[model samples]
Target chain A: TQLLEQSPQFLSIQEGENLTVYCNSSSVFSSLQWYRQEPGEGPVLLVTVVTGGEVKKLKRLTFQFGDARKDSSLHITAAQPGDTGLYLCAGRANPGGSQGNLIFGKGTKLSVKP
Target chain B: DAGVTQSPTHLIKTRGQQVTLRCSPKSGHDTVSWYQQALGQGPQFIFQYYEEEERQRGNFPDRFSGHQFPNYSSELNVNALLLGDSALYLCASSFTGTGYGYTFGSGTRLTVV
Candidate 1:
């Protein structure tokens, strides 16, 4: 079974602060995706990184896929109270049987206080 | 366009009772997947359905079953519910040829008493 380990299980920072969370695994993946979920709601996709050493940015969030495809990271710049939520990283196995299934990390819960 | 939709936004069931949850895929989507999310934890994959068949499943038990309809809608049924089964059930939809990401529904919150 593949497992994704996420660091900084909990984060609390003031507005304007910057933070980075990581997801690591021993197994390689075809792609990695980042998601943000508010309480009582399902996760919303933030970005998908398909290539090793690839980086993608969306507004104040930056996502990076590792060179080995076994790790990924999300960095938030100028965090705001609205940016507070649970951040999740999921990985897709190489295409094959049920490759559509996502292996998710425990997630990083962030709270940005104004 | 509407995204994935799940029914029974909240449910409370006694142990050993049976429950069935429903999901409708997003427009133009052909596949549906179910997940279980415990409080403060990430969602865990339960299974995926495509073409009215079970394409893949996760480590869940047989008590957890699902069915997909011709219209790409799906149902998840759980039998002899245990308190451990209490969690938020989420449904996600995606097209076969589309990229790896999925569109998720708000989810159904189940509380097993």
Candidate 2:
């Protein structure tokens, strides 16, 4: 079974629409990371949120870590065609003085139509 | 400096044939991790190597083995490859520091016929 699950496996929307992808898990994590991948490249780290209930904004993207540290969300405002790609969520448990290994979600495929 | 890089961008092999994949971590990083990703799915961790020694490993079978060099580059060898082993192999590098930022390579695509 997938330790972390992403919702709405696929999403397609017109330009300028708002969208949000959810990542949920039963296990608590010290940090959750968000990444975006193009067609042929590997996943690139977008941001890392350490504290629970933390919210970070990356231009049109807003990332929030759940208060319980067991879930996270990615909201994009005014998504453009350039945003079309696979968005992934990864979690790292026992962050503070431990080894860094990430558990990934299945990922949400998104498409923005112009 | 360049980011993490993997070799043999794409390869095709038949069943029972062994294959080797190589990876060179980014500058200033010491830890290396390997993951296997099938189409339309998330990556599954294979193992992690540090100081030329394996520090952690995943649930992969013995068919998957790896070695780390003094320069921090790594090589993954799959013995008695099976058709089920066809997937994209990715190498990620991370420094066990404050950031410990894990940077991934573009990946090497291996197809077993």
Candidate 3:
């Protein structure tokens, strides 16, 4: 009963390619966050999206939150080997729901080859 | 300033033994939360400590317990450890009121034999 489902659990792509990772859930969230983790390190926060149907861009990375607040996506353009890592999507339940606890997805493991 | 800090980066224990892992929250943070991540799995929330009290808990059993010190540091204790307890234990720190923008430690890898 995973609260959030992430698609393409594992991905391998060459440099300069583009890829998108999806995180879907049935329950609405107050906010969603994206993180990147390398081996032997804790996940690092990339961005946080709170408004429904909002899109945010960070250099080559683009993040979008669904209008219903139940899904999110991460798109990387011209991906480079430096983008290789585990991409995790975490959703924060609405207030008074789960005490606003964060629910995490299994994550998408990405490998960008040179 | 130092981020969250976890002790005993790695540990190996035998079944039936008790183990304690420690964490120090980031500067100015007042709340501590613990999470367990199994191999190839996402982290599952264990519990959160705020104002030296257990604020929220997940579905873990009684075998798992924790404490928060006045300085906002936390300790996670496991009683009667089982082989299945092997996993990476993470500590995240954040402000109590905001409850977001968590700062996570590298985590302690625990292996129960």
Q: Model 1 - which docking category?
A: medium
Tell me chain A's TM-score in each of the predictions: 0.95, 0.95, 0.94
* Share of reference contacts kept by candidate 1: 0.58
Tens digits of lDDT, candidate 2, A4-112: 9999899999999999999999999888899898877999989998889999999999999999999999999999999999998988876652265678888999999
**Model 2 spans with C-alpha error above 4 angstroms:** none
Q: Which portions of model 1 show Cα errors greater than 4 Å? A: A96-99
- Measured by TM-score, how close is model 3 to the native structure? 0.96
Tens-place lDDT per residue, model 3, A1-114, is 439999889999999999999999999889898989888888888988888999999999999999999999999999999999999999988653224457899999999999
Better of 2 and 3 by DockQ: 2
Across B11-99, the per-residue lDDT of candidate 3 in tens digits comes to 99999999999999999998888989888888888998989999988889999999999999999999999999999999989886664
Question: What docking grade applies to model 3?
Answer: medium
Interface RMSD of each: 2.5, 1.9, 2.9
* lDDT-based ranking: 1, 3, 2
- Tell how far residue B65 is off in model 1, in angstroms: 0.5
Clashes of each: 0, 0, 0
What order do candidates take by DockQ, descending? 1, 2, 3
Question: What DockQ results do all the predictions give, each relative to the true complex?
Answer: 0.61, 0.57, 0.50
Query: How well does candidate 2 match the true structure in TM-score terms?
Result: 0.97
Write out the backbone clash pairs for model 1: none
Q: For model 1, what is the error of residue A12's alpha carbon versus the real structure, in angstroms, after optimal superposition?
A: 0.2
